[model samples]
Target: MTGFHYKGGLRIATLLCFFFILDQPAYADGVRPGYQVVSRAEIIEAMRQCDDYDPTATTNGARFQGEMILYLAQKARARDPQGLPLFIGYENWFQAFMEVTARAEDAMPQYAQLSYQYKQNTEIDYRIDRVIREIVEAPTPELAVNVRIWWEYQPGKPDRYSYMDTLSTPNLKVTNQRVMTYRLLDFGNWVAYDEIKGLTGRPTSGILGFLFRIIGEGHILQTRMAISKDGLQFNRATAKKGFIKRIDTVTVYPDGKMEKDIPPDRPDLLEIAKRITQPLEIDYAELSGEK
Candidate 1:
């Protein structure tokens, strides 16, 4: 399958779009208490300070935990008009990947053996760390990274993936294929994967083949994912870009019943939000001899 590559210009456009939408009242209200718009300078300073800041020096590390809570809240609030946060995209992507792979492994235990090989053999250009590190290291007017992923799965063979970055590739006679592309934005990454499906897999010699020749290939299921840079924290997933535009507290039942704008299942984020809104438990003024 073909790999996807986007130039640096898209990042600029994405950032403009991300911040422009923040002017809306809905976006303003999206930020809960204790969350502030953190600048790059502040992010850098916090990273530096917290790297060495000893939470153990204080009572039960409450102050350090408080600082982290504040940092997380600040990052979480850094969402686009679509409500995709900046700090947890990686986590989201990983979760989705694991879920799919888990099902595959459960059905075919043989898939588990090639898991490591797929990562090891994939093209270097689109490797997860390589893509993220390249973006983090040289973020500017001209970007050099081409973010994309390609994988082909055959029932008994090791998965084939990410050999080239192109629009389309030659189809295998019996392989199932997936093509994934990444739009690395200043705010976060937009990940879209298309699972090749439908009559496209039919032979091109008979009446079905003649119809296929006229209509080309089959339909693709495109799943759009938005994630933070490190791919470890925030995410908007499982649907097209515009479907879930905002995050609301709701629950869905197995029977298709829906609850709109209800309380969330977990209170961890709420507690963190409350903690970040308060003063640090430790007094920094009294500390001496450490920078």
Candidate 2:
């Protein structure tokens, strides 16, 4: 887990500028009516204030603050529907912040237990815990609108991974849009088997081990999925620079029928892909909170 460090002077300056904007009559409502753009500075300030509100300061303080932030964000979004971008940004930040905090606390006990059991130098890296750094609209066809959520691992870490999740829909103004596409880009880490074998033993030494030896330690994995009126399509790819490259795709019809184009030689890989693609029936409408 990474600690949150504050730069007081920089934050103060940003807040001062935000207050100046808020004081102007034209921007009295916390929005620039002409451009229909919410003040980024003010958004930043609100996020900072949320971060500064320590829920653990007193009994149940954290829960209270969390609820308050959620309420305020919901109200803000309703008050200025045109400021959806700003509200969404704040919501993403707050969600990530809470996730990181919870994961950090959870990891402590798990690490201790693992260390005791192994009697070796062991550390738990909450690999999936990330902070949503930014959210921006992505360019897409005129019929659809899209947004990307950028997330990063622990700040300032040398091996930190940065990635983005994209969500797009054909109809942005409606809640009944069933067709959607979700993409997860740059989400996996690559490391050689020899590097971490000491920590994680060679569980198997058959064909899998041989294949690993041929390829380098680290391999990147990426996946994309499309959900439409017809059905769902999922594609997964794995690659090791100049070594291994393969892609497998699967399609599921609305009638609960599935088809695949996996190579017969790699049934193991096909099985893995099937497992990964299983249970991917996420609700896009619920996820986007459009309704």
Candidate 3:
């Protein structure tokens, strides 16, 4: 159970390496820009022209609703590959999410099968105002938000579900866990919690224990990567005395054990985690002026 921390809501921080491909193509513009991308500059202006947003539906119980989208936008873009656009179209994605959430809640009382699946619940709406706030505040690199959900349906009685939780997968799609976990398991370097424990007969605590034991009692090590930085731009200055940068902050397990750096080239766990929790699509334009 020693895994990623659920920051308020669930977001998979690791990825599986199993094979399954997507058939959808990117927009005709080579990279189709969505309103979320456009709203970056228009965020504050949008807020000025904005009104109240019903807080009950947004994720973290609307902690990221209203004026918060601006920061959230920045956080989403910071990790983007320069010119990447927002995934979903329309304005006020968060507002759209609120509406959807409201709709889901409303339809819940009457709608029967609709309860099994709904897009909004998986991915939190990437509202403009909220995006802006996260960008300016966080210490780490800002990244676009996405999520994945797991559903349980019996064979003949598909309605009866024993348990349902968002399963971790490595991809940015709000798909079921089967696809997500498949991707990571394909990665040659990755080893699953269940499989590893089954093979290793020893009473190992967990992956954290494995990491710490390697760093402490174990005696095999080497440097991972070397990125030299002296006069700022290393690409521009070919001739300069660069120094090695050592990372700080030791990782501590629940058992109070400490460890150094984690395994290298182990199929970027964070990205894997990221891919698993795909974002739910929402249209923000529907939320303009609070209708």
Candidate 4:
């Protein structure tokens, strides 16, 4: 039920700078270069203290978390010029858990008595919730975050898949294209081969062909995300359905330079997607050998 997510852009003018920005780091025993790690609670608490934030707000939790992530990067960079902002998908995890809740609410028919299990789920959800810190060392300061939504391996069940597609320019104009920067991972439970075979009346012996596997055995399945951006709008869509979207009601560039970035109207896990990608349009442009 675990996966890795890395989102970066290019057109770097010099391989040296690109390598300097990325390749210099060497990993050993869980230590990451350019920054240090802090527990998710520390980040979350710090965010609450970031401003006169109202806890009663609809996305109070996420707003604070997002602010903390931003301020921490701004602070860490000031202290360590070479630091990059590395945010682990802690909020992503929370949103996914919320989706579980949403699912239960919708499918009450199949999961009536299992309501007691929901409480236990929340505790585990928080414990695993986390956001790792990293420093931004790009030649030009960039902003972007990676989204990793993959299929959880489910024992005896088929692995779910997902991808994304872009919105038209007009649609992008209205929504501001922020939803385009993430992947739509499915953590949902899927039908097992046994369950399908029961209805299909198919043979299950020896995989029918005698020695092969039809489905993976595990609990979760997911797919990776691809990203694209235009002005304050971005898309993290695949070629089709089964994707997660984070649309912006207002519009602004990620770097805050354009002043057109949009605040999301829907902040729910399935709806609102935070700016996971840091402000990097400028940095990426510099890398592109452009002025």
Predicted model with the maximum lDDT: 2
What TM-score, computed on C-alpha atoms, does each candidate reach?
Answer: 0.21, 0.25, 0.19, 0.27
- Tell me the whole-model lDDT of each prediction, alpha carbons only: 0.25, 0.26, 0.23, 0.23
Candidate 3's TM-score: 0.19
Model 2 lowest lDDT segment of ten: 9-18
lDDT of 3 by residue, 185-237 (tens): 10111111100100011112546345434543211111011111110000000
lDDT (10s digit) by residue, model 1, range 239-272: 1122322222222222212233223654543532
The clash tally of candidate 2 reads 5
Q: Please give the lDDT score at residue 93 for candidate 3.
A: 35
Off by over 4 Å in 3: 1-136, 139-143, 152-259, 262-291
- lDDT (Cα, tens digit) per residue for candidate 4, span 1-291: 101111110000000000111223555432445334433444444434433423222112222223333344434545654444333333332333234334444442111112112111111001011211232441221222222111123355333211110112121101101011121121111000000000101112333212212332211111111112222322222111124222222222223221113344523322213323322111111111100
Worst 10 residues of 3 by lDDT: 231-240
lDDT for residue 291 in candidate 1, whole number 0-100:
6
> How many Å off is the CA of 163 in candidate 2?
14
Q: C-alpha displacement of 151 in model 1, angstroms?
A: 6.2
lDDT of 3: 0.23
Off by over 4 Å in 1: 1-114, 119-145, 150-179, 188-232, 238-291
Candidate 4, residue 200: how far the Cα is off, in Å:
33
Q: Backbone clashes per model, in order? A: 11, 5, 58, 53
